[model samples]
Structures are given as C-alpha cells and as structure tokens.
Target: MLISALLVLHVIVAIVIIVAVLLQQGQGANAGAAFGAGSSGTVFGARGAASFLSRLTAVLAAVFMLNSTALAWIAARDVGEPGSLLERIEPVPQLQEELVPEDEEDENERDEDELDLPPPDSH
Candidate 1:
C-alpha cells in the first residue's frame, strides 16, 4: 500500500515537471529584442522564469530519485526468500526417491575409475 501510494506521487511529480519545462521559453527568446519585439519582457520579469522552474525541477527530480530507490529496495527484499521456483506445488515425500533413482554398483565403479592418457610431448 505504501509503495503504491509513493508510485502515484512519483508519477504526478514527473508529469508536473514535464509540463513546467515544456511551458518555459528558451534562452534565445531574446533574439526578438533586436527587432523591438520585446514579448519576452511581458511573459516574465527582468530576472526571467529560470529561478522558479529550476527550483521546481530540482524538487520533482529529488522526489523521483527517492521513489526509485524505495521501489528497488522493495523489489530486492521480495527476491531474498529461499524457496523453489515451483513452491506453490505440494511436496510428495514418496515420489522423491522415484524422481531420482539410485545409481547401480557398475555405474559407481565406472565413475571411480580414472582415465590413463599419454603425457604431452614438449618441444
């Protein structure tokens, strides 16, 4: 529940940041000043809208980082359990031995025998 809530908040902040950035004007907007088009002056004051947008972008970015970390931690915790991939299937003790048959004596002897090979010739 906590994770879901945080995810929602993270998405909201991301959308807000994207919209705010798109609405803001670019640096070269002052090129119109040469033609006396001065529309930039009316949209935002002399200092410009950088301060407000920068602060908002910083806040939203911080929240995005924090929520990403939290989600990763939650995912890591959930994978740390010790169990088989098919844990939902019921265990049958009687079938265990049948699943893996015991090795015969001849097979064991073959496994114990070592192979003899000629030594490598050195130049």
Candidate 2:
C-alpha cells in the first residue's frame, strides 16, 4: 500500500517535471534579439522564469529518483516463493494404440515354420 502510493506520487512528479521543462524557453530563443525582432527583456524580468522552472524540475527529479529506488528495494525484498512453468501446465491425455494387420503377422509365422532343406543330390 505504501509503495503503491509512492509510485503514484512518482508518476505525478515525473509528469510535472516534463511539463516544467517544456514550458521553459531554449537558449536559441534569444537569437531573435540579434535581429531586433525580440524584446530586450522578459515578462518574468531577468532570468526569473528560467531559474524558477529549473529549480522545480530539479526537486521533482530528485523525488522521482528516490521513489524509484524505494520501489526497487521493496520489490526485491518482498518477493514470494518461485514457481515452475511446468507445474502450471495441464497434462495431455494418453492416446489409444492402433491395431496391427493379421496378414503381416501370418507372414512372419510362415517364414519361421519353413525349414531349410538340402538341395536334391546332383547325380
């Protein structure tokens, strides 16, 4: 129960971290200033938005890492007895034997019954 709660928190923080990172502007965003197409200042004032977003992202990331480690530890220590794959499978039914032909058996008997006799004396 505790691990499950932590997992949920971890997922939520991860999503927030992603959103925070995406919301921040890239370094290249300032390039517009070189062509005078951008404002010399930001609405957040100097470095305001960047610093706040970066700090939030860092904190959430740390929490996410700690939660992941806790989950791994819990899983490893709480595992139950191992089971075999063969034990879960159902046994197959035995097949009936097919009948043999009578003629084949008779041929074997006849071969055994015949006795080897010497050829007639060559006069």
Candidate 3:
C-alpha cells in the first residue's frame, strides 16, 4: 500500500517536472530586445527566471529520487516465509519414478533430433 502510494507520487512529480520544463523558456531565448528577444537590459535580469526554474526543478527532482528509493526499498524487503508452489498447499512426498536421471544417451538423442531438422530455403 505504501509502495503504491509512493509510486503514484513519483509519477505525479515526473509529470510536474515535464510540464514545468516545457513552460520554461529555452537557453537562447531573450526577453529584452524587440519582441522579448534580446537580454540586454531586462527588468528581471539574466539569472532571475533561471534561478526560479532551477529551484523548482531541483525540488521536484528530489521528490522523484526519494520516491524511487522508497519503492526500491519496499521491493527488496523480505517477506515472512519462503515456500515453493508445491510446498504451500500440501506436504507431498517425492516420487522416485518421476525423477529424471541424468544420462549420456539423453544428451545424444537431443542432439540427433536437433540436427535432423532441415534448413530453410530462402527465395
């Protein structure tokens, strides 16, 4: 439950980061000259917008990292007990006849069967 919540939060943060980055101006965008093109003598100055965007991006990025770490920690946690599919339901005794014996003949038969197949004819 906690892990699921954390995953949802991480997804939300990712979306926020994407939206924030897209709304921000590019590196070469100038906000002073003509149609907000040049950055000669702007009121907000050079690093104002960059500083705000950087801080916002940093906060969201930190949240994303934290949620990722939390999810990983939850996934790596050990459960109460470990048991096989057969062992979980009932305690069945092993059947001696069902066991496969490792023999050289089995290997040779497999190889022969594989080699007998014909190769494909490409047009």
- Candidate 2 yields a Cα-based lDDT of 0.78
- Give TM-scores for every candidate, taking all chains together and pairing residue i with residue i: 0.52, 0.55, 0.51
- For model 1, the local distance difference test gives 0.73
Query: Where does candidate 1 have its weakest 10-residue lDDT segment?
Result: 104-113
lDDT of 3 by residue, 22-45 (tens): 887764555445356554565444
What is candidate 2's lDDT per residue for 1-123, written digit by digit as tens? 888898899889989999999997776676666566666575333454447888898998999999899999999888665667787678999998987877557543555338677878999
Best by TM-score: 2
lDDT for each candidate structure: 0.73, 0.78, 0.74
Which pairs clash in model 3?
33-38
Model 2 TM? 0.55
Candidate 1 segments exceeding 4 Å error: 34-49, 82-123
Candidate topping lDDT: 2
Q: What's the count of clashing pairs in each model shown?
A: 0, 0, 1
Lowest-sum lDDT 10-residue window in model 3: 42-51
| For model 2, the run of ten residues with the poorest summed lDDT | 41-50
Candidate 1: tens digits of C-alpha lDDT, residues 9-113:
878988998987887676566666646666445433256445787788788888889888998888778885578779857777775444444553455344424
